[model samples]
Target chain A: MSTEVAIVGIGMHEFGRTDGVSGMDQGVVAVRRACADAGVNWEDIQFAFGGSMAAGAADTMVSLLGLTGLQFINVANGCATGGSALFSAYNTIRSGVFDLGIAIGFDKHERGAFRVNTKGGGLGDWYGASGLALTTQFFGMKINRYMHEYGITQSTLAKVSEKAFRNGSMNPMAWRRKPISEEEVINSPMLSYPLTQYMFCSPGEGGVALILARADKAHLYTDKPIYLRAAVVRSRRFGSFEVLAPSIALEHNAGPTVDASKAAFEMAGMGPKDMDLAQLQDTESGAEVMHMAENGFCEHGEQEFMIQAGDTEIGGKFPVNTDGGCLANGEPVGASGLRQVYENVLQLRGQAGARQVPNDPKTAYTHVYGAPGISGVTILSR
Target chain B: MSQVPVTEGVFTWPSDSPQLIGSRCVACGNHMFPVQQGCPKCTAAETEEVLLGRRGTLWTWTVQGFPPKAPPYAGNVDPKTFEAFGVGYVELPGQLKVESRLTEADPEKLRIGMEMELVIVPLSKDSDGNEIVTFAFAPVA
Candidate 1:
């Protein structure tokens, strides 16, 4: 039987802009802080797996992290980069080859909507020329169809953002920490139909790192080890509606998030109800609403009532995005997934001071979805 | 006044009623737009080119409220002059849902499951002063 892995230390650079600091430098800071938290030396880490989208090579950090000459792999799986890095580190320790390692992710993106190059994104010139390559349009179109089908109201959408900012106000690391009223959110500039400016998460900069060790030896690093129950990544299946696609087949199919969520629950031997809290991708307000259902937390059209009932609030039945999530953190792409993991670790260990949930949470779940249709889900427990 | 297609094989040109070009799998019957070599559903290698239907229903839509960045974006840059455009997926019966621009820019004017017909509209002008045309879907009267 394969051995289990446990996260002994977690650290993060505040999720937002840091003008002068390079992305790689932020990563180094995160790694150092994680080492300090785990009470382990940099020389103790046996291997490393890291990723960054627009930042420099992750392996180059060894110049400052010390020339340990350990095996380091760079992952670039779009928005799932952090989750992919953690998944690799988990499997490595489970294979019994390495006793300890670290997974890191960081990115610094330019202002405004993420630009998709026609040739690089595998899209034809006509696609960009006609303005069909924008990611915001996809989000708006998707939520528009969903609202029509499920009877979700505009107020529900605003509520999701309101909760994000409210929770963000309690968390120091969040970029958008000021709470905006629902009316203000609705009255905000409409970037896409039905989605206001406040509803969207901007592209920003930050870094996060987590140190993992074999479950048997986890006690050597920290007293409270957060066990990693499962880490799974999945890609889009046939006929699924995804970004950058010019056409979709008539046959409908579930998106990648469903497959990844199911596999994660099965692997962890737990259900959605068992999760004390969750951190879901909130690229925009609609994403969180749809992802909640897609991850099997609720059925389609249930988010409308769930948001109204305040079930996803910090004091509610099921707290989500307790660290403000991507909506408040301002997604740094590479660091976004690991930021979720970091927040879960803090919450599971009861270290989240201001943003702590009502109950002492033992189990946590995280899900992230991004371009080209890929999703990563992870389950953790104290 | 000279006019040219933005890209060939996307949609037929110089016709009163134009249809989009797509690929259909010979083995599994999967359809894809702008033509491709293989099937994404059944992994079938053999496929045939076919002309898609002219009329379809709006599957979903949204309005672009601001101008996109340049390099990839080849549209009007001035924010004050940039016109918000409607983008949507038009599902042709028994074929596939093609993502395209809608002639209508007003979100209030568009609705789900509305009947739409294909039209070729001028997107922009090339360096040679030729009108570059592309496919779009318009609400049918």
Candidate 2:
């Protein structure tokens, strides 16, 4: 099928904490930069989809950008919020309703362990009082089980974070940029057993914006247009083990990432082998390891070998997470999903400095999976 | 002066061997914890209240050191004095794998596939002086 949505411009407000910088202002910075990068005026956007977790509504930008009276919808689908916004824009533009639009994501949260209100989130007093409400516990349990079943070791998990920090040092937009040894990551304060402070991404503040236009109108904005080949988002049904869930009856079906990537690969008529690189979600080191398998990049039993053999770095076979990923960049929730897309565009356009994969990659894949098992996957090509 | 459940409708109180309060689809035999009116698996409306297995094997576990983020964790305890605890998924035979608080926190004391049994423990006391009881799993000898 012909996917006709093109990303003409991508901009990001570096993924880090900025005191006194409101999420809205961060969004304004990204949006204006994207509009300028696309060579289009803010007034040119006819519609918009925005993702903000703790931030306010999508209409919050209206006060800054002026009341253009555009259709702005706010998305809050966990970590996939930004990816959903991108697809929402793509689907809307492909239907020929709106010619041009923008997708923006931003978030700001207090430092330390990210608190989740389980009152209305399907978790209750029991989960919270027992400390089971924390997402760290989930990641720890999942990885512990994975390691027990497979032969994966602590060294492999530490190596994933090592690669992330190494790559993050190269990307100015990344959050934790200092390159650390695997020993540091392994010895860091253990949040949950096996997952240390370095393994988990802290909640921070950041923003990202992507300008989209019809394929035919894309060149009117920029010559190095990144076409959206496939965009798919999926939700958890039954038997999917994920964060924030209390119990499971049985795992009778696939997880959200598996379902999402499967649908995306089918829609794009391209499989994992066709892509040159990826930005698999790494909320923790285990997430990247698991998602790489979920997204069809490798088998469940191969991550240990691949990561141990130095095959996941920039020059490796797949070169996944070339832009430091959530592990190194720190998750700003709403902004993280599009941050993956922003890096993918840079990689495709040959604009990713220092961390760019060799031999101008033609196609790229990005995937994000979040709490309670919601997933989003996108494919882009030059 | 009395022990009450932290939340109602989750387990039987004042019993020797209490099973998790759950529901099973009468038609498809799917089980759910804390009770769901409708079966999510087969979408069947015919369901009945049932007790989950008390004995199970450990599937996975972890130790949470810091205090959980507040609000729904509603126990009135000082964050600084909060002690570390173990949380895990237990595979109950003929039932689903359910998340549980472990009786032990030390990693050396825990192991995957170890036999475990449900036990009632105090979570926190309520304002009324009642000990808020919750479910946990202890390694079975």
Best lDDT goes to which candidate? Answer: 1
lDDT of each: 0.92, 0.88
Docking class of 2: medium
lDDT of 2 by residue, A258-329 (tens): 999999999889999999999998988988898888899999979999999988899998898888999878
B-chain TM-scores per prediction = 0.96, 0.93
> What are the per-residue Cα lDDT tens digits for candidate 2 across B8-111?
78889889888899899999898888687888888888889999989999999999776776654654347678777889999988879889889899999999
lDDT accuracy of residue A351 in candidate 2: 92
True contacts kept of 1: 0.87
Model 2 ranges with Cα > 4 A deviation: A1-3, B74-80
- Per model, kept true contacts as a fraction are 0.87, 0.73
Tens-digit lDDT track of model 1 for A1-382:
9999999999888888898999999999999999999999999999999999999889999999999889999999999999999999999999999999999999999999988877877779989888888899999999999999998998999999999999999998889899988899999999989799999999999999999999999999999999999999999999899987899887788899999999999999999989999999999999999999999999999999999999999998888888888889998889999999999999999999988976789999999999889999999998
Q: RMSDs, each prediction?
A: 1.0, 1.5
